[model samples]
Each structure stands twice: as structure tokens, then as C-alpha cells.
Target: MIADGLNSKVFLAPMAGITDKPMRKLVHSFGAGNIVSEMVAINALSRRNAKTYRIADVRDEPYPVTVQLVGSEPKLFAESAKLVAELGAYSIDINMGCPVKKIVANKSGAYLMTEPKLAADIIKAVKQSIKLPVSVKFRKGWDHKSVNAVEFAKICQDSGADYLTIHGRTKSDMYSGNADWDIIAAVKQAVRIPVVGNGDIDSVYKAKEMIEYTKVDGVMIGRAALGRPWLIAQTHNYLENGLEPEETSITLIKQTMLEHISQLQKYYGEKMALALSRKYVCWYCKNLRNARKFREIYVKINNTEQAIAEIERFFAENGSDIDERS
Candidate 1:
């Protein structure tokens, strides 16, 4: 039940398509307690798919990165866990919390919450396949009528999970509604192993509030950090030092935006990175003056050079050294 190599108390939650290597690298650079990979489908990784393998690569990362695997079959989960272990992952996390319809329909993700036996089998299989610490991330249950996070927590512990993460919503809730911290608290109370609470945590204050309320070991932040990667480090510093985070300057924000695109270009190549940078720009420019108008022109951009120039021009026009949240 002891989780080693998980020394930090604030972590970045795994978001599909959003928590990629570039994003993970950026957040890690700012000092998060830990970061989890976007859910890598066990089926693809077990088959040695190039794209999936690339997603699972964390060997070169200088942080404790847990590679999260999602799929229905326990055998494929075992194979993928072993592959991730070989790739030097800090740990292997079985993703049973994702609520995407496609994932649920495949008898995976939140659907696993409906079948505790199968979920236990998956955890056992992955545990037996790798020497790394094992963790399970799951929701309260499939629906409100079926809330079982407390029971599920015990199952995860009995099946050999070193720790657990419980998002406060159910599969039916998806990402909507207020997350029920009561269930998260219940899960923490039920399990002897460490539990990290997730869902609806957007600020360092809320992160501290959730830990205090649920008594979970830590907090996992998701969408709230999309454009604000530094929030993770801010939360960490606040928790460890009780110091309030300083207001980030517009210049540094622009610099981070530039660095983000550069990292995207390095990992995904020029053309693809240009295309992908559109969403990132949208996230970064939120609430800024002319943000909507600028994004309209930005996403249509096709050339990498043009995209970089636009970023430079937009940031320059906004301001250089002040907080310009309009």
C-alpha cells in the first residue's frame, strides 16, 4: 500500500489530447508534484503502434510521470503496463475514470465502474506485469443511482493498487455539474492507501480546500490549467510555503506561449505543430483584449513562420510588462 516515487502533494491530471508530451514537459518545468500521461489505449500500445508508443514514452523526462493505460481487456492492459515499465515510467496508472462515450461503449473507462470484478482483474493484471507502483483513477460510479467510490476504493486496495484517484463525478455526470466532494471524502475514508481527489479544482485555494475537506493525500488539477500551466507550481508553492503566488506578467505569459509553440514544433514537427498550436493559442489568449478576434485569424494560419509572427504581434499590441486581463 506504500506508493514510492510519488513525493509531491499536488499533481496534474491526465487530459486526453491535452496532457501530451509538450504540455506535460511545460507543466513539469514549472514544478508540479507529478503529471500523468493522456490515456494511452492498451490495445494500441500492446500492438506496438508507433503513435501509441510515442505517447507512452517518458524515459527521457526528468520527472515522475505516470503513464495511464485505458482498455477493456486485462491481458492487453498487462502487456501495455509492461511496455510502459520498460520505457522507464515512474508508475503505471489504470484509467477507469474517463467518461467519453466512445470509451464507455467499448466497455472501458467509466464503464469499468459498473464491473468491479473486471476492474479488479485489470489492476491485478497490471500489478503482476510490472515492478513499478500501480494506481487506479476512477469516478464515483457509473451514475448517481450507483455511487460506489467507497466500495471501489477498497477493491482497488485489495487488488494491489498502491494508491487511488477518485474524481467526484460519475460517468453519467461527464464533466458537468458540481463535483460531489462528499464521495471523494468517503473514498478516502474507506481506503487505507493514499487517495488523490479530482474534478472541479481550478485554483490553489480550491486545491487546498479539497484536501482539507476530503482529507485525501493530494489534489489533481485538470481543465483549469489548460492555458495556465504555472498554476500547478503555484499550488505546490502555496501548499508547501503558504506564500501566495505572484501575478504573472504579460511578458512572461507571452514568453511561455512562444516556448509552448516551440516545444510543440520540436515534438510534433512544423506543419502539424502549426495546426495544433491553434487550440493552445485559444487557451492562452482567453479574456485578453481582442482575444476572440485574434484567435479567428490565428487558427486559419497554415505557415509556422506566420503563426509565430502573429503571436509576437498580438502580445506586443496587448502590453509588454503588465497584467492585461480584459
Candidate 2:
């Protein structure tokens, strides 16, 4: 069952630099059960860093806005969690699953998995500092040789974390190889609180399969939602009504791309929007007939109008009817 006040069981995972405000808004609009802000560093936030604060902004988005914070110091976690609660976050997620070398070097992210007592202390501090529901997202363990997710989950539960998200990979694996669902199932059985299974759930079938195989309370989609925000809605529909999703139409795809551009432009001004649109353009047009060529051209564009014009031209040349308004 979903947590109280949450609408669905599918969640959009917190991807740093990718799940920004515009992306979160788009995915939430597409009916993702919950959306998490990109992981913000507690040290930067406690220092009132402008860029960090900007990235953590969740004004006017959907309910249950979960702000994810990553850091090693328990005091900083407490301070940042209080700030996030004051900023109207519905929940606060401690990010212990990030596998980046830089993050781990700072004694944060998956590095905490190696120091379970420290991880538990941070969770307790954050939970004590805020009224918002506290959750922790972590990996299986430090490495393949030491898989400690079950022990870690128990530590988090005992420390007052209200929920847990487990990515079924060790820190050493990074994003390579297959995520061990058995590990996630083990975590679920070990913890009484809701456990969210994450990693490699790139399709609706995978989402359903993970839910059934692991008996997880939910599934968190990360890389899969890059271009296809509708996947969240489609997965929700499939799970709730047993409806299979059809291939998205070209017309709808173009419209979705246009809408994404519009939201980006509104959030970040035109110039920054144009720059940011390049990656998303590549994601949206990845399967098109001339995707490589389209990406080459998209990367060279310097303005929003030029980006929009190229998108229209590209789709029109590919035989899709243009909906300029979208």
C-alpha cells in the first residue's frame, strides 16, 4: 500500500542535475506518484549557497515534494532538514545511494553504507530536526564483497526513518551490471517501514516485475524518465487498471517536446533554456530516423527560437504533422 496522502506507488528518482524544477513539474503533471528534488549538499545549503538553494527550490510543484540531502555530518543534516521543512517540503529524503566518486570521497552517499552507525546517526538527527516524514535512499552496500543492506535497513528503521529506498547495487558496481532484486527483497523483509526498490526499472514490465518479485512498496524510476515523462503515468495506469500502454504517437511526442521546451524557457530564461534543451532534445529524438544528425544540429543551436524551429523542421521532414502551439 502507498503511504498516506501519496497518490501512487511509482516515484521519480532524484537524479542530480537532471531532475530540476522543470523536469519535476513535467513528471508530476504526468502523474508520477511522487517526485524528489535532485540531491542537494547539506553543507552548501547550510552555508546558504545560492545555486544550491536554487536547485532545491520546489515552489508550486505537486504535494509530497521530497527534498533529498546528502552530507556526512549529522549536525548539517539536522540544519538542512529544518530548512527544507520550513521551505514547505512534504518529506525529506537522505541520499545515501549516490555512487559518484566525489560524493563518496566526502564521506557521504554510498560511502555511508560502509559506516552504518554514522548513517543511522544522520537519519536520527534529521528526523529530530524536522516535522516532515524522514526517508533514506541507499545502495546495497560498500561493495560486492560486503553486502549489508539488510543490516543498514534495520539501522535506518530503528533510527526513526519513516521510509527507505534501496537501490540493489553495491557502491563498487556504480551503474554497471544488473541490480540484484534479491537484495532489495531481503531489505523489505528486514524493515517494517515502506521500502522502495530502485535501479534498472527502465520499463513498465520491469516495474511490475520488480514489485512482484521483491514485494516492494514501490518502484523508483531514474534514467528511464529522462525523455519519456509519460512513463510514470503509463506505469500507474497499467498497475491500477491493467491497461497496456501503446507506442506513443509521433504527434504526441513532438507536442511533449515542445511543452518541455516551453517549461524550461519559463523556468530558466531563453539562453539557459536553449543550452539545457540540447540534452533533452537528444533524449526526445533518440529513436527518430535521423537522431544522430538531429543531435548534431541541436547542439549547435544558440537560441530558443532556433531550437524550436529545428525541432519543427526535423519532425516535419520525418512526416509528423507539426502542432506549433504545443
Each candidate's lDDT (Cα)?
A: 0.88, 0.86
- Candidate 2 regions exceeding 4 Å error are 320-326
How high a TM-score does candidate 2 get?
0.95
- In terms of lDDT, the best-performing candidate is 1
- Per-residue lDDT of 46 in model 1: 74
Tens digits of per-residue lDDT for model 2 on 284-324? 77677777888998899887778889888988898453222
lDDT per residue for candidate 1 within 1-326, as digits (tens), equals 22787877887999888899999999988875688899999888877899999999889888889999999998888888888888878898899988998998999999999999999999999999889999999998999899988999999999999999999999899888999999999999888899999989888899999989999998899998888999899998988889697876777678889999999999999998988889989988887778888899998889988998888889788775333542
Best by TM-score: 1
lDDT of model 1 at residue 199? 88
Lowest lDDT sum, 10 consecutive residues, model 1, at 317-326
Give the C-alpha miss distance for residue 112 in model 1, angstroms: 0.7
